[model samples]
Target: MHFVYMLECSDGTLYTGYTTDLDNRIKKHNEGKAAKYTKFRTPVKLKYQEKFTSKSDAIKREITIKKMSRQEKLMLINKG
Candidate 1:
């Protein structure tokens, strides 16, 4: 399965991405080897995640989440 995931950073910012392994993905994010965004905003907590059968679907979800305003992102995360 692929995952569309959100992390709430220690700095109160949010990060979104698509991954095949949620556990390893979060580990990579905390280790500063995930996305460039999460690299600088380390030590994130997994706030939300959705599983999809296809990577394309997860990536599409990631793109939509990334385009959202902060408020909208927060709403999405909280809803998850």
Candidate 2:
């Protein structure tokens, strides 16, 4: 399964992305081996996630979440 996920960074910022391996992806972010944004914001915590059967769907969801304002994103995360 593909997954779209949000991370709450150590600095209180949010990061969004999609991955087939959720655990590994988060591990990479914490290890400073993922995206540049999260690399410096290490020790991120998984705040939310949605599962999709297709990679395209996961990517689309990631984009949609990325476009949301911080308040909107927080609302969504809280709902989850």
Q: Please name the candidate that would achieve the greatest lDDT relative to the true structure.
A: 2
TM-score of 1: 0.91
In model 1, the runs with Cα more than 4 Å from the true position are none
Top candidate (TM-score): 2
Error of 1 at 15 (Å): 0.4
Q: lDDT by residue for model 1 over 1-80, one digit each (tens)? A: 99998899879988888889899999999999988888888789999999999888888889998999999988887777
Each prediction's TM-score versus the true structure: 0.91, 0.98
Task: Supply the TM-score for candidate 2.
Answer: 0.98
Q: Please report, in order, the local distance difference test score of every candidate based on alpha carbons.
A: 0.89, 0.95
Which pairs clash in model 2?
none
